[model samples]
Target: MRQNLSVEEALEAILEGARPIAELEPLPLAQAYGRTLGAELSARVSHPAADDTAVDGYACREADTRGASPENPVRLRVVGLAPAGQPFSQEVGPGQAVQVFTGAPIPLGADAVVRVEDTRREGEFVWLLRPASPADIRRRGEDLVEGQTYLHKGDLLTPARVGLAAAMGHPVLPVVRRPRVGLLTTGDEVVEPGEPLPYGGVYNANSYTVAGLVEEAGGEPVFLGKAPDSPEELRTHLAQTQGLDLLVTTGGVSMGERDVVRKLLEAEGQIHFWRVRIQPGGPLLWATWNGLPLLGLPGNPVSAMVSFLLFGRPLLFRLLGRSDPPYQQLRAVAETRFEANPARRAYRRGILRWAGGYRVASTGSQSSVVLRSMAVGNALVVVEAGKPVRAGEEVEVIPLPGGKTAG
Candidate 1:
């Protein structure tokens, strides 16, 4: 198995083996928001199927209103009124006009529309004081054309896109099925939240954190419960992932004697790589068991969360048929001094802001066990090994999911 791989190398290895889910299901346009499109969608019909009036006005021939003014008005007989969704059936002759409301189809043989405010009506007779123009009409198929493809496969259905599909005469949309991910946490020191906490025991924070990350990446997380550091228990828990698309486990991946997860993968599963060259999350592992993709994360709270963001999130996106980048990186100037680790790359949590230009400052401590650091920070500043960064130096920063920068 490969060991001590760079962050990019490890990500490439994981994504190289990923396959998008093939199952598809149709969902109503209202419920298909945020889902990936499974097929190309074309418009079924044209918008404004006929030439319609854009304002409340009178439809009349332009020649009839020529030289019309307040001093010398043109008088025409108002034969009929056409409201929205109803068209005037009869033709409008040179001496006649039709009262047309907004969105009403223009009457036959009428080429111009004069605003109601520009005319006076009395006893079926209308007087035009100004000449009318054809610009007041909305031509047929102006907004959307029939059979035109507006959305393609693998496109994310956002709110505006959903409305577009609806306007295209689609009541439902075909979308890729959400991948089911099995999540498991190991360690005798971990216990379920809300239960009585014994001395030296901690709550299972990794499960919720990783599960939330999976959900945010368009995957359905199935909790496999916590497992002790025993081989028998871990194996039994692993067997529960029969129909799942992916499996993720936290803890028991390091070289400690109680790391039964790594031992089990070594014996039965195919190990692609172990131990990435990253600080706080160096014990990352990737493997496969019984033809299922598996990703093992470190036991620390911060480590598990960071590893999932950098690695697991991208895998989920691939399965969902999305081409989004794994993480967004930007250049920012350091607001404070940042210490460097000599052996491995460091990902220091920090607050990112925009003041004239991008600026970042560390969030106090960089300890792996300090979960509060992630809660208060919106970005991660990457520092190369053996390189210390001073204030005012430009550094590489990755903005976290759902994080917004202060301006």
Candidate 2:
């Protein structure tokens, strides 16, 4: 097993064996929001199927409106009316005109449209104050062409894309199925929330936190409940993940005497890596058991959450057939001094604000067990190993989700 790997090296090892789900399902346009497209979608029909009028006016031959102006207007007999979706069956001759509303199909033999503002109507006759032009007509298939592929495979179905699909005559869309991820929290000191807390016991925050992160990454999280630090109990809980694509466990991955998860995996499953060179989340583990991929995260609240953001989220995206980067990085000036860790890369929680430029300040103590630090922080300041940053120095920063608002 590879031990003490860098952040990038461990991620490479974890995703080398990852594969996107193959199953595809058809969903109604309304329910397919945020889902990935399973196959290429082509337009079933053309928009504006025929030459249509773009304004409320009269459809007449351009020759009939020649030399027409307010000083010497041309008058033509109004023969018929053409509203939207209804066509005027008769041909518009040189001395005749057809009243056309917006989106109405232009009458046969009419090559120009004169806006209503440029004409004066008097009962059966209408006067053309200005010469009409053919530019006022919208040609057939102007917006969308028949059989044209507008949405490609692996495309994300956003709101505008959904509307475009509807306009292309699709009532439903073929979308890739969401990956199912199994979450298991192991530790005797952890108990479910709302349950009476025993002495020196803590609530099971990892389950809910990891579950939420899974959902945000476009995966369905299946809770496997909490398991005490025992080989038998862990095996029983693991057996529940028969059809799951991935398994994630919090705690029991370090070298503590009670850390039985690693021992069991080493004896049964294939271990790919053991630890990462990252502060607050160094005890990371990746393995495969009976053909199922398992990712073990640290036990601390902050460590589990941050490690998932960096590693687990990308794995979920790969399974969904997406190529989005794990996080958005930028350079920001430091508002306060940031201490350095000589041994491992550190992800320090901080708050970012826009003041002519992005300025970041630490969010107090950077302890692994402090969950409040993540709550109050809007960004993560990356401090490279053995690099200490002073105030006013530029540093690498990754803005947290939904924290891009300007100060």
Candidate 3:
């Protein structure tokens, strides 16, 4: 086990040797939502493919409309009609025009489109009431060019990206396989929710919390249930996750006699780090068991969840090959004064209100065990080690899932 390290140092240590998982799976466009692209996707076909009309209009040579006005409009013979997906076979010539609808291919030899409203049509004759410019044409490749890369590797398949893929004629996309994470909650006194709770026992909230967090981080959670305090029973639980990409456990990492997670990992595999220099999550542990990365979080509900957000989530992103995933920092004004730990960074739950600049108010007592404070907070008011913040002072904040502190 390594010595206690600062939060930054711990993060660096955890990710220093990390490498993205190299598993690719082909998925249909409809099933690729929320999946990360495994490779750069180039456009297969240019959008529009050809110059087209942007509105229902007359396709004619720009020079034909010159000097044309409402008083003495230039008259042209209507040669043919071009509706969307049906192009006029005949080209536009001098004193000739083609009726074109929105998205219709611009007739050959026509340099501009005169809106239908700007022309008067009577049988095969049309009168242009105003001059037209070449700017009215929607040229080929205006939206996306063929052979150009539109989506890059590691991009999440959002709705817009999916639409782009469809527009580019990609029926299937190569996506990274979601990391399989084995989740185990370790504590003899922790009872599964809905089960009869004995005296001195608490419901296993950490399991559900970590499972949901794992799914949001782009992982497929394999719940291994609770691991009893006995080393033998813990070993049985650990053995069930042989093929998982990573293993995560809440509880049993603290410096207590029943903290079997750290001791078991150290004995069977390797414990690279045991602690971090951060409040509410100082007892976090990282290790590797049988070649699979293992992250052990504290037993407290809030500490376990906060540590997952800070550490486990990033690891999952790295595994999916994402360089960055939209987590950002912003500055806010403190509505209440707060003290910080002399040696550890602190994450205080707060609600951020926008008034000129962001003003943040603490949810309640910043205790590690207080889960209610985290539920009402949309921002994490960050404080550096040894830094005491005063009311109205500008402080850094990290926006949570729901946010008002970000752009």
Candidate 4:
């Protein structure tokens, strides 16, 4: 095997070259928070039916308030008060106005609004400071026109976007259901968590961690327990499980002698090695078997995690028909002095952030076996392959795998 491939070459081997919607059922919007979209969603209605008061003020005709100044203001009697969720009783005529609160529907024949701060109240009479025009009012359908599309098809259902759909009066939405992800971990030296560990056996962290990551990436994870080192048992266990959108296997993907998953699924799909030029996740294997994504991950906990983030995460979004899930790669200004070796690009785990207009990252270590570093890190510091990046150099950093955004 070659040492490492460029990021593009690695990605090419992993991806199927075309994106298609995965097999999934339609789920109600209430239970579809993290689910990927299956199809496009259309707007139900326009934003507002009429001109609305964005602020709490009085609505009146601007022409009626002409000649009104700070010194000698025009006084108009407040005829009615309109609050949100209710209609205004009377329209503003000459020398008359309606007191409206925020989000209240503007009364008919009202042109402009005068804030309460610029007015003096004397019983039912309020004074205006300056001349107001009808042009000062928000026009009809200003926020959104009727039947306009706020969100198009194949869009992810982010919380804000969901709220936007709700604002458009859509109670239920048509979104793609989350695909079921079957997780399997293989290693004779792995033990279940909360169990007494025998010598040379460690607690199984990849299964749970990967399951959590799957759920976070909008996929339903099905734990297939643990598979032993035998190839027959692994093949039988995996072959029996059906209707899965993806099957993820960790701890048996590397070239180690105990690695058996690659050979077990050899006939089902063509295996391709991806030397994803990133440290801790350099070795990657991908294929499609029986209309399902088969991703064989590295044995090291850190390596498995990085592979899932860089490749598996985006694949889930694409399968669910989310054109661009919330995976933003932002460049934080350099704040600390750090160096990298000339090899694979390193995805340094640390608390990456911007403070005083500089990027700061501090990870405990870059070892592929450390889970403590991943626990405390919020982002990845990207170092280019085959080169060293000095402090203050701008490097692309992908955000920690959370949220519904895209990369």
Candidate 5:
């Protein structure tokens, strides 16, 4: 097995450096988020059925209202009114106007909307000052043509993207189902949560934490909980992942006597690599059991998280068939002088926010045991192994919770 690798090398191994996640079941549109998009969604009946109002304004015939200036002004009869969510098919005669709200369909025979602001209303007739131009009109299907394609296949269904699909008339969205992940955590010193922790022992947060991250990354997290260091226990855990799309384990990956996770996996599965040249997350591991993907992350909080992000997260996303197989990476500037001289990639827990036009990040302490930093941090500042970075320098970052956070 390979050892002492860069974070990218570990990620490449996790991506299998080759074979992709097998196909998954078809999913519904409503439950698409936290799942991947396997197929592209096409337009059913096009969009914006016809020329409609883009703003709340008066719909008037262009010919009748054209050149109706502020000085001379043209008077037009108000024949009818139309509100949003409703459309009127009645044709507008010359010198006639229709009170229109935003999104209201422009009546037939009317080519322009002289905004209500530009027109003075009367009981039956309205006085228009500004000249209505072709620009004022939202041409029929101007937003989308008939049978035009709106959403492409293989796009992640974010709230905004999902909304777009909904607008495009996807009733039952055809999406790839969330890939199921079997989460296994191993450590002799680690105890199951909700129980007593003896001296030098703590609860198992990696299981729940990484599971949550898996879900946010668009996969179903199957909580396998903590597995003992025994080969039988490890075998049972690995066996339980029979139908799962992926299996991710925390701890028991280092080359220690008690680090039996890899050994147990090796009994049946093939070990591809072990160890990485990264701070806080060096003892990373990867394997394949019966053709199912397996990941062995460092047990420390920060290491596990970094391993999950750089390795497991993207693999899970692709397996689920996310519209975008690989997630989008963002760039941010270092908010303060951050120090690291480790021989491996350093993922510093930190917070990032927008200042002026730049997104800057501050490095929180890089301690693997620090949970408070993870709680407060919005982004993970990525520093290459042995790379020294100063304040105002640029670095890569991944959001902590995987969505927009409220300041």
Candidate 6:
């Protein structure tokens, strides 16, 4: 097991063993949102399969209404009406026009459309105030081309992509199955929310936070309940998750006497790496137990959450086969001075503001125990090891989930 590894080194090691599943499933377009595409998607049919009108108008040959104004209107015989989904079967003649509504396919011989507001109907005669141009007609295959690949493999099925698939006449899409992850929060001092807490015990917030994060990253989280700091109880809980793709445990990763998670994993599982050089979340442990990926996070609420954001979330996205996850790193100027750790990198919770440029201000108190600072923060201002930054100094920030940032 490698101890005291750099953040990049640990991440490289962790991902070396993580591989995306090969199984694919077909899902309906409406149910595929947030799922990763397992296969590239191509349009089966062209959007607007035929040339159509952009507005309710008179579809006629441009030469038929060459020069006409309000004072000297051109009169053309209205032969037929074409509404949406129905087209005039007859070809437009030299002195005749087809009345077409918006989205109606243009008649066979028509080359232009004059807006309805520009013409008036008198029984069988339609008056044109001005000449029309061919540009008013929407050409066939204007939105999507048949046999063209619009969505690539590993792309997340967003609402826009879903709409595109449907527009191209695809009712179903191939997508990767969501990864199943087992969440276990260990330690006797932790109690589930809504349960009466005994003396010296605190409510377990990491379970819910980790569960929500897992779901947001396209993984299904299965709560395995809290495990006491005992080798037998921890082993029993770990044994019950034989079908999960990954196991994430909070607490019992540090060098404390009660840290049974690491102790148990070391005795049974293969430890890949531990102790990343990061403040507030340095004691991160990565291991594999019976061919299952296991991640052990620190006991502190902020540390566990930050560790998951930096590492666990990306791993889940990888398992889902997403080439690009939603988590992003951007540059911002520090609004206030911040001290850095002498030997470890720090991720300080803060709110990002955009005035003339992106600016980040620290949420009060950077203690790992204070989860509220993380609750109100929109970004994690990254400070390199041994490099303190002053006000107005530029730094890298990782945007948190669902938080709005400056443009």
Q: Which candidate leads the pack in lDDT?
A: 1
RMSD of each: 3.0, 3.2, 2.1, 3.5, 2.9, 1.5
lDDT of each: 0.93, 0.91, 0.88, 0.74, 0.74, 0.91
- Per-residue error for 356 in candidate 4, Å, reads 3.9
Give a tens-digit lDDT track for model 5, residues 51-160.
Answer: 77877778877878767878988999988889977777698988788889977888888888887888787789899988765576566666555466766656667777
Q: Candidate 1: which stretches are off by over 4 Å?
A: 53-79, 93-102, 110-136, 355-357, 388-390
Worst 10 residues of 4 by lDDT: 398-407
- In model 3, the Cα lDDT at residue 107 comes to 89
lDDT of 5 at 95: 79
The Cα error of candidate 2 at residue 224, in Å, is 0.3
Backbone clashes counted, model 4: 12
Model 5 misplacement above 4 A: 17-29, 66-71, 82-90, 323-331, 357-364, 401-407
**Any runs in candidate 4 off by more than 4 Å, and if so which?**
1-5, 22-32, 89-91, 132-136, 267-269, 274-277, 288-291, 332-343, 403-407
Q: Per-residue alpha-carbon lDDT of model 3 for 19-41, expressed as tens digits? A: 88788999999999988899999
User: What are the clashing pairs of model 5?
Assistant: 40-153, 51-140, 154-323, 155-323, 277-344, 278-344, 278-345
Error of 3 at 212 (Å): 1.8
lDDT by residue for model 4 over 1-407, one digit each (tens)? 33356766766555656365555565555665655555455556655667777777789888778889999999888889998878696667787899888778889878788877778888999889877545445666676666777776567677777777677776766666677799988888889988999999989999988999898877889999888998877877788559887889887766666678766556555666634567877767776656667887887998898889888887777666776853677877554544564777777775675565436465767788998877877777777766555667766677687522211
Kindly list the per-residue Cα lDDT of model 2 for residues 1-407, writing each as its tens digit.
99999999998988898888889999999999988888889999998889999999999999999999999999999999999988999899879999999999999999999999999999999999999889999999998899999998878788998999999999999888999999999999999889999999999999998998898778899999988999999999988989899999999999988897898999989889999999879999999989999999999999998889889988987888874565789999998988878999999998999999989999999999999988899898999999988999999998876566358
How do these models rank on TM-score, best leading?
6, 3, 5, 1, 4, 2
TM-score to native of every candidate shown: 0.88, 0.86, 0.94, 0.87, 0.88, 0.96
- What is the alpha-carbon lDDT of model 4 when measured against the actual structure? 0.74
Runs off by more than 4 Å, candidate 3: 402-407
The candidate scoring highest on TM-score is 6
TM-score of 3: 0.94
Candidate 6 stretches greater than 4 Å from native: none
